[model samples]
Target chain A: MHSPHFSVIFSLDALTGALFLLTAIGVVATRQVLASLQLFIAQSLLLSLSALLLGIALGSPHLFAVAGITIATKTVLIPWLLRHTVSVEVYRTREIDRVLNIPSSLLIAAFLVVIAYAIANPLLGAVDLPFARINLPLGLAAMFLGVFTVVARREAVPQLLGLLALENGVFFAGVAIVPELPVIAELAAAVDVPVVALVVGLLTRQIHKRIGSTSVGRLAALRER
Target chain B: MELAAILLIPALASGFALLPTNRHFAAPMTVAATVVVFILASAVAVRTTHTGRVDALGQWLTCDGLGALILALVALVAMTAALFSWGYIRIRAGHSERRKEQHYYALYNLFVMSLLAVPILANVALMWVAIELTTLLSAFLVGFEDTPEALEAAWKYVVLTTLGAVLALLGFLILYWGSQVAGYAPFTWAGLVEAAPRMPPALLWPAFLLILVGFGTKVGLVPMHTWLPDAHSQAPASICALLSGVETTTVLYVILRLFPVVGGTPSLDARPWFVGFGLLSVAIATLLLIYVRDFKRMFAFSTVEHMGIILVAAGLGGAEAHLGAAYQMAGHAIAKSFCFFAAGAVATVFGTQEIAAIRGLVRFAPLTAVALTAGAFAITGAPPFAVFISEFLIFKAGIASGQYLTIALLATFVVIAFCAVMFHINRMTFSTPLGSVPATALPLSCSATLAVAAIPLVVIGIYVPPALQDLLHAAATAMGG
Candidate 1:
C-alpha cells in the first residue's frame, strides 16, 4: 500500500509548527536569560525544520536553500556572534529581569494568541492554501507572543531573544505563503538576523560596562522633566 | 553605471577610512566620497526629471521619479553632515582620541552608504537589508560619545528599529505571497503594482497594515516614536543631522511607495489610516514641543511633527497636495538638518542644550544667535523659508479637497507647534544670559556648513527652480497624484 504522503507531511509539518510556537512561548515565560537564548535556538531549529518539510511538500528547491541559510545563520552564526560580542556572564545570568511577572505576562500573552488567531482567521479563509491552515495562525500567534516577550522582558539579552523569536514567527508563516521568494528569507536569515544579534550584543556589553547592568529597562537617565 | 558607482564610492570610502591612518585622513576621505555621491545623485535626479527613470541593473537597481528625489535629499544631507562632522568630531575628541575619531568616520560613511542604497535598490528584500544595515552601522555612531545615556539610547534605537524591520519583513514576504497568488512576478514595487488589482484583498490588507505599522515605527509616528527623541538627541549633532534629516524620510519613502499599489487594489483604502496616524502624530508632537526643555529633543519632536504633515499631505490627495508632500519632504530635510546644526553650534558655544540655560545669545554670541533664530524661523513655518511654503501649499490643497475637519485639526496643531518652537528659540536668543556663560566661537567648518545649508532653506521657499519643480511634479505623480 502506498503511503499517504500528503497527510504525512501535513501532520509532520503541523507538529513542527506547534513546537515552533511552543519555543516562542518558552521565550516569553522563561526568567533565565540563558533559557530564553536556548528557546530562541530551539525555535530557529524548528523554523529550519519546517522549511525543510515545506520544501519537500511544495517541491521547491528555493525553500531548501532558505532552510540551510536559517540553520547556518540563525542557530550557528547568531549564537557565535552573541558569545563573542557579549560577555560570558550574560549567558550565565539566571535572574533575567522582566517588566511583568510570569503569570501576568503569560495571561496577556494568551490574550495576544487569541487575538492573533482571530486576526489570521480572516486571512486564512481568504486563501485556499492547505499548509497555510497550520502555519499562518500558529506563526501569527508566535509573533504575538514574541512581541509580548519583548515588551515584558527587562534585560538586554532576553529582549533581543524576543525580537529574534518575532522574526522566526514571521518566517515560519513565510515558508507556506512565499516559498517562491526564498531570496527574502535567505537574505533576512543570513544578513539581517545575525547583524541584529551582533549589534545588540555589542551594545549590551557596552551598557554593562558603562552602566554596570544589562537590565536596560531600568535605564531612566534620559527621561524628560 | 552611475547608480552602481554611487553605491560603490561610499563602500570603498568606508574601507579606506578603516585603514590605519592619521586622524586627518578619515573625515576628508568621507567628505570627498559623499561629494562624489551627491554629484552623481544630483545627475540621477536631473536625468529622472527629464526622462523619469534610471536603471542600473535592469530591475534590481533602478531609480524612478520619487526615488531620485529621496536620493538627492539623502546625498545632500550626507555631504553637508560630513563637512560639519569634520570640525565637530575633532573638537569633541581632541588630539588624544585619534582611533575613536577614525572609527566614527568609518561608521559614518557606511551609514550614509546604506541610506544612499535604500532609494536605489529596486528589490524590496535587499532594500530592507540596507535599511537594517543603516541601523546596525549607526548604532555605534549614536553611542559614539560613550556616555551611559548615549549607550542606552543606542541600545533602544537598535533593538526597537530592528524589531520594526522584522515586522516589516513579514509584511514584505506576505506581499510577495500576494504577488505569487495573483500571478508570478518579480517582487519589486512596480511588479506589486502590476499584480495588485488581481491580488486578493485578504492578502493585500494584512501586508499593507503590517508594513504601515511596522515601518511606521521606524518613521517615528506618534505611538511608535518613543525611541526617536532619545536617539536623535543623544547622537553627535552631525549624525543627528543625518538621522533626523533623511533616515526617517528614507524609511517613510518605503511606506509611501505602497500608496499606488494599495490605491490600485479594489476594496482597500490607505488614506484614512494615513490621515489618522498623521494627525495624531502632529497633535502629540505639538503638545510635547510645548514642554521640551532640551533644545536637541525639541528639534527631534519637531521632526515628528513634520513627518506627520507629510503623511497628511499624502492623504489629502490630488496632484497639488502630493506636490506639497514632495516639497514638504525636501523642505523638512533641509530645514531639519540645519536646525540640528544650529543646535550643535549652540551646544558648542554655550556648552548646554537646555533651552532655559542659555540666554542673551543675541548679545553674547551674535553669529550663534542669528543661526538659532533663522533655524527657528525656517523650521516653524515662518515667512521666506521652505517649510512655510510647503505648509501653506498643504493647507491650500487640503482646503481644495474639502477635508475641513482634518485640515482644521492639522492647522491648529501646526500653529501651536509654531508658537512653542518660537517661544523656546526667543528665550534662547534675546533673553539675558544666565549666570555668566562663556560663548566659545563656533568652529570654522560648522559655520561654513550653516551658510551652505541655509541656501536651499531660504531659496526654495521664495523660488522653485523650473527643473526642480518638474522633479517635484514627477515625484508627486509617482505618489498616485
Candidate 2:
C-alpha cells in the first residue's frame, strides 16, 4: 500500500515536470503571434494545476487561494482582454518574422536548459524538500526559454506574450522553492500582471492603428539627438 | 498634524478639484491646495528638527530625516509649479477650452499627490504602487497637447518604463522571498531593515541590481533615459518642471531607500556599478547636449546629466558625499524647474522650441531673457548657484575616494554641457532677431512665477542654513553612508 502511494506521488511530480517542459517548448516552437498567445494561456493553466497539486499535497490553504487567482486572472481575464484588444484577425493572417529559425531557436533553448541545470544542480543538491532539486533547473530553463522567445519574435504581441511566459516561469520557480508567498504580496503580484496586460493591450492597438503594424522595428524612428 | 497636512490635503483636494465647477475655478483651487500643503511640509521639516520624526495614518506613513527633506523639496516645487500652471494654463485656455483646462488641473493635482505619497509610504509594495501611479497619471499630462509627436512620446514613456517596472516587480518579489527565507513575517520597510543582516546575500544582490536598473530607468539614468528628452520637451513647461524636478527625484528616492538593505552585504558592492553608470550617463548626456537642437531638449539632457551627478555622489558612500547628494537633489529640483519655466516663456514669446528659429529673446522680453540666462548659468554649475556648490562637493568627495579618472571625466563633461547650454542661450538672448517680435509682453503672473522659481536657485547658492545642513547630514546618515 505504501509503495502504491509513493508511485502516485512520483507520477504527479513527473506530470508537473512534463507540463513545464512542454510549455517551454511550445513557447519556442510557435511562429504565429496568436498561436503564441494561446500557448501562453495553456502554459498558465498548466502552472495553475501544478500549483494546486502542490498546495493539496502540502495542505497550505494560501497556496490554494493563489492557485485560484492565478488560474482566474492568467488563464481567463488577461487572455480574453488581450485577444480583444490586440485584434487577433490581424495577427492570425500575417506570419511573424522570426529572428531565428525554429530549429536554431530550439537548439539555443536546449543549451539554455543545460546551463540552467549546471547552475541549479549544486545549489538545490542540499535542499530537503521532495522534488525541489529537480524542479529548480526546469524553472530556470523555462525562464531562459521565455526570454529567448521575446528576443526571437518580431511582433509586439508575441513579445508581450513572451514576457508573460517569463513571468509564469518565475512564478513557478517561486513556488517550487518557497512553497507559498504571503497572501498580500501574491495578490499584489496578481493584480499587477493584469494591469500590465491592459496597458500593453492598449498600446498595441494604438501602435497598429498608427504605424499599420505592431513590429518593434518600426519603433526605431524615435532616437537620441 | 504636519504629515496629514502634507499628504492628505492634496489627496482630498484632488477629488474636489475634479468636481464640476466653473472652469476658471480649478486653477486657483489647485494653487490654494498646493500652498496649504507647502506650509504644512515646511512645518513638518521645522518640527522634525527638534522632534526627530512625525508619524501619521496609523504609522503607515512617517516623515523621517530622509523623507522629510524630500517632502519639503516636493512641496516647494509643487507649490511654485502650481502657481506657474495657473498663469500658464490660463493663457493656453485662450487657445484651447475651459473644460480642457479643468482636466489639466485635475491631472496635475493627481500627479502631485502621487509624488507626495512616495517618500511617506511605509510599505515597500505600497511605495511601488505610488511610483507606478505617478507614471500612469502623468502619461496623459505628458501628451496633454495630443499632437502626434506628443502622443508618441507619451506612449514610449509609459511602455518602456512600465516594462522596466515589471522587472522591478520581480526584484520586489525576490526581496520578499529573501525575507521569507530569513523567517520574516511581512514585507514592510521596518521589517526588512530589522531582518537585513540575516537575509541571504545571493537573493539580495540580484534584487538590488534589478531594482536599481528598474527604477533607474525612471530616474533617467543612461541607456534607459531615452524618454526624458522627448517627454520633457513635448509637455508644457509646468509639467516639464514636475517631470524633471520632483518626479525623477522621487523615483531616485526609492532606490536610495533600498541602499541600506543591500549596501551592507559584504560580497555585493553596488557603489562601483552606480559610479560606472553615473559616469557613463554624464559623458553621453554632455556629448548629446552639445548637439541638441531644441532648448527644451537641452534642458532635458541636463536633467540626465544632473541625475548622473547625484548617483555618483550617492555611490561614493560616505558622510560628506551623501550630504552632497541630498543637497544636490534639492538644488537640481530648483534649478531644473527654473530652466524649464524660462524655456516655456521663451517658447511662448518666440513661438518655437527650435534653436535655429529663435533669436533676440532679450531684445523682445528682457525679464524672460535674464531669467533664461540665469537659469542656464545655474543649471550648468556656474558661480554662486546651488548646483555649482553641490557639484563641487561631489567632485571633492570623488577625488577623496581616489576616483581620479571619474572626477576628471565628470568635470570635462560638465564643461561641455555648460558650453552647449551657453551657446543656445547666448544665441537666443544676444543674437539679432531672426523672427518677428511678439506684440505683447509676458504677463505679470508669468514673470512672477519665473521670479519665484529663480529665488531658491540664488538663495541656496549664497548661503546654506545650519538647520538645512543638519537635515542633509541626518538624511545622509540614514541612507547608510
The DockQ leader among the candidates is 1
Give the clashing pairs for model 2: none
TM-score of each: 0.98, 0.89
List the TM-score for candidate 2's chain B.
Answer: 0.97
Docking quality of model 1: it rates as medium
Residue B75 lDDT in model 2? 88
Write one digit per residue (lDDT tens) for candidate 1, span B1-481.
Answer: 7899989899889889888877789988898899999999999999998887999866668998899999999999999999999999998877698888888988888899999999989888888889989999999999998999899899889888888888898889889888988887777888899999988898899999899888988899989999999999999999999999999999999989999999997689999999999999999999999999999999999999999999999988899999999999999999999999999999998888888888888887788789889988988899999888888999999998899999999999999999999999999888777777766878888999999998988888899998789889999999999
Query: Which parts of model 1 have CA positions greater than 4 angstroms off?
Result: A1-4, A182-185
lDDT (Cα, tens digit) per residue for candidate 1, span A126-198: 7788888898888998888888877788888999998989988998998888777746547655787888888
For residues B355-466, what per-residue lDDT tens digits would candidate 2 score against the true structure?
8887787778888889999999998999999888888988898889887888898889888889988998899789988657653556566788998877788888998888
Q: Kindly provide the TM-score of model 1 when superposed on the true structure, using C-alpha atoms.
A: 0.98
lDDT of 2 by residue, A74-128 (tens): 9899988887888865567444456788889888988998987886654454334
